[model samples]
Target: MMYTVQSSGMLLKRFSANYVQNSTRLASFRQCERYGKFHDCRKRISHWLKAQGEQVAQACTKQCEFIIAQRIRRSLQIFHLYTRIWDEVALKEFMKSWRNRALRNSRHFLMSSIGITMYNWDRERITKDELNGYKKEIEGIYRLRDSTVVCAKCQLRIVIDVRQSGIKYCTCTDNKFNATSNQDSEGWKPYIEREDMLIWRREEPNCGGLFAYKVYGSFAEVTAEDFLQAQIDVDYRKEWDPTARELRIIDTDPASQSSADSHSDVIYWETIWPKLFANRDYVYQRDWVVDKERRLIIIISKVTDHPAAPSKPGTYRVTTYWSYMVIRPYTEFHQPGIEFGLTYFDDPGVNIPSAVTAWVAMTGLPNFLIRMREASRNYQNYKIAKQSLDASDTNYVPLKNEDIFEDKVLHGNMQNSERSEILNGKNVEDYNKIEHTEVPQFNEDLKEEEEEEDSTNSSEEGRGLLDYFYLAKLFA
Candidate 1:
């Protein structure tokens, strides 16, 4: 039951800086990305029930619906844990108790044979062994116990459990509840959905920052390694993330070495913005870890100070933000592929209002994610082509499409689009029409019926892990 404390204070410093506030605890309830409202876990289930028809919903007992909601909540908490690690003493103690309770509960329920299997949002199965393995990992955190976990959902400090639950909400105790028969419970709702992307924002009372979640999936023939490599590749990132004007590693922790095990570095981020707004810059410590056995990769970038990088002009310096990315194999719908969950909150260091920023997130964020998927596939294809041929071969040369088109334009074989020129007996208009392909939009109506569940003062607060996963199940 003993925990290690950091002598260097680095981990302690990080925990202190990213600690969540009580008021923001209620923000943990999954909200509809469009309306900027909250939905109770029960309402989400009720909506599902009603969809099954009035007879089915009525036939479903309150307890059965509650159980479903609980399972979903547990599934989501497990996903949240994959995003980051929490090793604080209190969290360790909670996990220990929860682990003991789960083991005991399993035995009492005659789960001693083959154990049980739990399904996630993507319908991915998590076995009892896997859950126990996750718990074992938490137990191993005793070596670095000073590291506190910031709740991915509530933005608060939390001790997570694998089953029948522990901490799902923080001190700001709204939106925390296990679904009972009462369908009148209050909760958050989905605000917007575009394709596989879900965008939700809440005015965080904790830090006065606009908290947003951009959850999306990348369904290309890309491997988890490929996706993670692209995330850390600065040069490759610039091509995909159009907003990234400049990205460079500015510093690194002397204690952590550059190896495949993990890498810790301070990066400088300068992103482009519209002419109406100033550009933004961020200097933060980016730490990455790859769990090969679990097929999960987590990257967290937290705002920090570095003597090498200072505030610059025409670029607003982002003083605070906790941005993290979770990448894993998404096997529910497609040929086993990678999916990413990204959550970030920052006080833009500008005069922009939350409403305006929220509007921008709803409209532009999905396109940015789509561009990312396309870019990853493009890069992967380029790599495959180069590997299959000799670089010096004239006929098999792997030239970028832009390079080929640039040569044609220089030779006057083709004119810019404005000229309405012809190429190979085909007009520019005809080529444009043939090449255009529309991207699929997101399904925003998944939980629109639960919008009325928005009430911060609802008597029903979620107490079990099911609250998180039920919404996750619907969305996943």
Candidate 2:
């Protein structure tokens, strides 16, 4: 949405759009207009409640499914199953409970944060030209997020955690915190001159001589005459009387910076304030493979030819290649976010039964779920065609292979293997069927599929490839 601007008889190239002003506004509009209109600050809690509705659904309904399920597994597995059936629940006790809590709380975050009065937005009908102008504006805004990718073909960084105590020689010098010098009284006069705006510690008069002042934008500490004297320098105009808590622009005592403890407390709060109130949506968005750009044919329905969709029943067959996929939950989120993974093979013929729905229910992360649902839709052409259903010739059995398994999260290897051995075999269709039914079966079948899993299994101390999985039945 670029436009040519003629200003002062010179053509200037610029961009603008309605979306450029706010990511939430743009992304929300792309999702649905009703969401964008009613979910502003005034309606934020209502929207938040809707979000909690999903969370509640995740808790109550998801848990209920595990209780009523025909198949039973471990407690962890039960939690996993709960996620799979979360959206299917008919009632949400959790949502009702959370909404009640919100209404009753009337706390600061509930009142000030989610309230509609917090933001500025335009709410008028826009004409085509006006819309186009906004479009260009937004394109410009998005350009900021378009990073100057250093390496388009960069390999994934190997994340290997080294034990801190094991390192003997270090090449880099780590900076040790030195708060002692900062405690000197020399800077006190200047420090008080700049930051000595004081507040009564409490409204009660009996709170005594206690007073607090903002040290940084985020921290507060009790005031002392010493802190004030440390900030001044010789030849400065200030003076101070310790008893009266008075100061003028006089020379400061460098040694007056005693009590290094106050600075530590200030540092702690300075580190915490922004993180607690920072953009929470980015935390949620982190879980997803967001804003994917790929080459896809513009598909439309027609009498002469039909656009195939993976979502439509019978449009695809369960193929062996993609039918067997492996996923391990990433429950320990480094940040506030959902955790899950999805990998589909290009040639596998096994039907992915509402994979988007499955993943949404599986992770219980709303933003991640939405991203996956929208992103997975462009793969209709990669559908496992129905013809693949009958590709199995019993005699021409695709050689079954010994499974290869590695704990990548616990180890440096990414669970990818290059050693595989083709063992007694079965038709690939059978393997595909098992994969669709058992999660582990797919992982086992992977040894057969990939070029790396070509060696014989010799290690047998731990769980076998199939037995190692927490619960593999869902894929079967």
lDDT of 2 by residue, 186-231 (tens): 1211011111110001111332221111111100111111111111
lDDT of 2 at 277: 28
* lDDT score of residue 335 within candidate 1: 21
TM-score of each: 0.41, 0.12
In model 1, the runs with Cα more than 4 Å from the true position are 1-188, 206-209, 214-220, 330-336, 382-476
State the lDDT of candidate 1 residue by residue for 307-390, as single tens digits: 456678777887867666766543211122455656566666665565665555554454445545555556656556556345
Instruction: Give me the candidate number with maximum TM-score.
Output: 1
Best by lDDT: 1
**Model 2 misplacement above 4 A:** 1-159, 162-466, 469-476
Candidate 2's TM-score: 0.12
- Backbone clash total for model 1 is 39
